[model samples]
Target: MTSNDAWWRGAVIYHVYPRSFQDTSGDGIGDLNGITQRLGHIAELGADAVWISPFVRSPMRDFGYDVLDYCDVDPMFGTLEDFHRLLDTAHKRDLKVLMDQVLSHTSSDHPWFLESRASRDNAKADWYVWADPRPDGSPPNNWLSVFGGSAWQWEPRRSQYYLHNFLREQPDLNFHNPSVRAAVLDVCRFWLEMGVDGFRLDVCAFYFHDPELKDNPPNPNRPSGKSFMFNPYSMQRHVNDIGQPENLAFLEELRGLCDAYSAVLLGELHETDAEKLHREYTAPGRLHLAYGYWLLGAEEIGAGDLYGLVRALGHEAHEGWPAWALENHDFMRAPSRLADGEAPMALTAALISMRGAFCFYQGAELGLPEANVPFERLADPYGREFYPAYPGRDGSRTPIPWNADAPHSGFSEVEPWLPIPAEHRALNAEDQGRLAGSVLARMRRFLNWRRTRPELRDGNMDMLDLPEPVFGFVRAREEDRLLCLFNLGDGPVDVDPPQTGFGTPVEGHGLDWASHAGRVRLPRGGGYFGELA
Candidate 1:
């Protein structure tokens, strides 16, 4: 492949939350063999790559994000040999592998963290972020954990407070320390040497903290809706808590490591300024691409919102490539959040066909809704703490539905770690393997269709200024031009073309372009495309 064939650029990545992707071991949780078994399905869907959530050795405190061993695979997932098999199978199928690398923190059970926390002046004492508590016997500052409460955890042995932007079991690593950054880079090198194509850096923005340990000021107006909307943490502007400038230098260092092997890094920026930070982080010589939480939010999808997001990044930076995603391990599926369960196929078609590289979570292609788990079945600690209110991420992390007729949707012979929704049984891969009109079939069709259009693969977007809820954009590269339109609302929308120079419906969804009286009628939650003469 040539430099222009930088596969990460404009390539669709399928995010397989490993624990939910497949369970070939029949162990109730997804594992490496399970992923190997599903590679064909991913390749068939037209995805050029796969981003598997952390399969590294973990205590499962934060469900694999809290890494216990960077160089080894957890037994729950499988051995390192199993991962090699998955990687080999994926590459054999011409698909790249982008694995998760959680840099911000590590599980308390990790050897490094354990050694660091063992004593005040141990060999790895400064490896993690540790600070002296205030004289008042309180946490060092007002910084809050994303999981909830103060970001500091008191360690009695050291008689100090340690910073943890997430669960207390997951302590934030001090990237400000050069040695710590070097060790993390070594971890990256370990995987890249193993032929891993790239990385999805978890909490890419939350790597550093204020040395002064200042307080985060309160946000005068907090955003509402979904889980965190009601939480007080939303009320405070998380300035000192995360998105520190010290992170950029470390990112540059990591980029240097990745560049040595031509490995791509998609930094996952989970912050208030995610889009802005995404632009800053992905600028040349920094990150290959940057994705944030905007697409995962519960905001209603609209033509205007989608167009605005693309335009925002377009205006924000010129050189940095943008990567977009609608669903992932942490968020509910798009169909469930959009309330467009009525026409999810059309919605998925519109989403994947947009102007940038997009990601589809496991089970998303099947149009799976968020499975509601009762309090007794909940496994996430965050959910347990805020029960009956903000249920945790387990709802979206259930097992993949493979066979409709098999018990537990054929995810496993044993009971799944989380309950599989009965509705998902009808939408399994086996049910759609040979049929049209199924969401799985539609995903395969749209992804394949999307790859054939070079204009879409690598082009600039010219958003059409049409009526409300009608998303319109012209994907243009060199001489090729394709007008893509979408009806993101629940009513029919009419698009009066500037002129009838549309030669034909180029991408071929079998729509009648001759009847397009220069005025195209789009059904509720539907989309269409046309090629200019």
Candidate 2:
């Protein structure tokens, strides 16, 4: 696998949120040194790579998402020397390192943004998205930021409004500006030269906005049942604000740059028609893989829903590849969101069996549910702005519990940036590592088993048409086939045998099924895997 050029195809990549992973400096914040020390856990867990969230220099307003410097590591995380050492150590463990690249935006304090906002005639004045006020001194268009309120922020120095899809401090970069594109590409080159295996592009779709600055029409599907419905941002069609066709050309240019170093590109696309966008963004000479908010933001986890999403994406992404993640930094944990009795371990098994590369968020293997954070302890700006309605992402970004008895669960010497959940203390990694049938143990077993099975790793997947509560799929690679069946419901489900013959059951940890006279009964949170004849 290390020798393969397309190692990311069907690979399992672990996402390490630096702030929650570990804190070696005793400053109540996780840093590069902590991640370097924990690379062994990821390697032993059978992950091919690790995708680290932003640790670049930032103002901490939006955490590391608001970058002030692209080439330097934040002092909070470590020095540039520390990052080089971390990268070297990770590679020694046979783990590829992927850094988070927030190319679309930069902090208001960033030199580029400061210079751009200083005066209208400055050399970098056009570096960021800026426009004059409308006739009534209002915003140029009806673009709303994801964090709430208007996307345009008033810059008194230039008497112009700058576009900020997220926090006001994080202004969107103007990719239409050739110099800005070159500067961003140079940032990529600097990290590549420093030995980053790849990058996880943040807000990939918001890179290029409509050149004409036309107003976005109101969303016809008002009161859409999706999350963040309380905010007006969801009520707009966003046709003019994002997902511009010009983004494809820029992505191709970015892809060409990455190809020079043999690095992979994974994009995080946000759009209503994500499947269509994923197809266009990942076509040849662009992103190697693109994952959208379909699974991450989905409220329903039924068999039909999972099957439809995977099938639709498979059909839409012609020559491109897809990556799947049940949970990430932005979403709540699977156990908290899933139905009662549907074990997080079961969901982990189901995710690994899917026909694409997998990204497992940190602490997910511990069966960690969403934590309860007091209003006073909230740190997420998004949550603060939409309080009561949306408590923000702080609950999901709590520190990882390493020891059950240690103060702050061995995350920090002092209190952490976010409160550690009492429930997670009982499910710490130290204790779970020694217990069989634990979520962590199950994840280790399944990931190790998945590595040996070519069908599950990079083979063709065919969804089985089983009855409700029973979702089954078959992964095949030429002469070999592995059949996977999962029970998404809480109670037991009796399922008829598939038309295709099933071979002897293959052991996958404790996942088992009872077959009697062509009828199989699966217990709650149960899964079965067998060789297909």
Candidate 3:
């Protein structure tokens, strides 16, 4: 599809965490060259595009999230020429590229922040959020950082407090400043000119905070059993600290800039009222799509829960598109998060069969579970602070196993930044690619199968009311309709066919379903797909 077709719509985008994808430079850390070398693997997986995590210049404090330079690549990843080669090679392979744009905050070492923190009278002084201390010499408000502790950091030079929604090294940018907005837009322009297809806006909701710096109210019902359960940041409703009204206007400006290049914009949103924010942020001239952690952060996955998520999004996301992801660099792997046996396989089918765009995380096709990283080997600050309880993201950020017998699982010639899990070696792409019924093979088949069926891609999905453990939906595009039924449980279950005309069962990627007397028998972790009569 051409860019004019808005290819992001109903696209299957693979997420690549550069540090773990592959390491060609022998630095034990994956880089742009590694990713470029692996583009063939992604193309072979049948993904339309790749959403690469941050590879910009950084101090590695928060990995690449704390960007020191937006326009340049870090030496760790490679040089600017390497990035250009990557972009060129990916496009030649018919794959679009989406870079991670950390517009919310920047490393304290960034030149902009350095100049801004120098003095209040400097040209870039107001580029970051700065506030005076309260009369008691405490923080201006009750804002809390997502990484734990106070959001406000004292700067002795200005004798003022600056806001940092994450680590103290990553200070929040002041979107209230028109110049800051223009500068960020210019950063986007630089990448667009360099041939990036689009960007995945990091912490898009945290762009503009409340102008008054008001205190956030406490949340009466804090969610339990989540990766962030121990985080005090979850205790508050976060009304004023994020999801500000000014963010919409700023997004419109960014959209205008992107529209000039026909580039897509995807937002990473976290809001108390996520559905509402998704609707507002993607309405009309805003972000092309917005996705929250409704599925990613769930401790349990149930049919009702999955149905409710889609139903809610269908209702709230009017005039806007939705993007769904089962696993990413930030969350636990789907196999470990979901049930054992065939449940992970079923969930993968369900994720790809959904109505909207899909973001398939790297190594997820191999059905890789969360790796068990020892406390001594942990490199994630978030996990270190809440160790044993949360275990941080290191478990999910381990290197991708390419070859089972190669040193470091073929990720690097030397030691990797994070140890490759032994379990992953058994599920390496090299081995799985040869197995007929492996998750990787199944994923390739399913994704390629999805491409031929318009009903599964850009079709209207209607949720079917089925019994427990069975979630059914019909994807229809004009006269073509496909019935999709999935059993989320481990035990075999029986489900009745829809009252509508039912055609013969369509061939699927090893998913078995037998129908007799209008009753369909679905094996555990099995699903059925057929054309509507």
lDDT per residue (tens digit) for residues 1-533 in model 1: 11344777678999998887778777889899999988999999889899999999888988898888999999999999999998999999999999899988999998888899999899999988899988999987888888888888999989998988889999998877788888888999999999999999888888888778789898875765574574677888877878888878888988888888889998888647667787778877888888877768655766677777776676222557777787887776666666555434555566566655777788877878888888899998878877777888888888888998787888888898999888877788998878887777767877887788877766766766777776677777777778877777777777677443444666455222224556777776556788875
TM-score pick, better of 1 and 3: 3
Ranking by TM-score: 3, 2, 1
Q: Could you give me the TM-score of model 1 versus the true structure?
A: 0.95
Clashes of 1: 0
* lDDT-better candidate, 1 vs 2: 2
lDDT, candidate 1, equals: 0.79
- Residue pairs of candidate 1 with colliding backbone atoms: none
lDDT (0 to 1) per candidate? 0.79, 0.85, 0.87
**What's the TM-score of each model vs. the native?**
0.95, 0.97, 0.97
Q: Model 3 clash pairs?
A: none
Q: Which stretches in model 3 have alpha-carbon errors above 4 Å? A: 1-4, 315-318, 339-343
Give the poorly placed runs of model 2, Cα more than 4 Å off: 1-3, 222-226, 315-318, 341-343
Residue lDDT tens for model 3, 402-455 = 998999999999999999988999999999999988888988988887777877
Best by lDDT: 3
lDDT of 2 by residue, 260-294 (tens): 99999999988566888887887889998788877
lDDT score, candidate 3, position 307:
86
All candidates: CA RMSD in angstroms? 2.0, 1.7, 1.6
What local lDDT does model 1 show for residue 51? 93
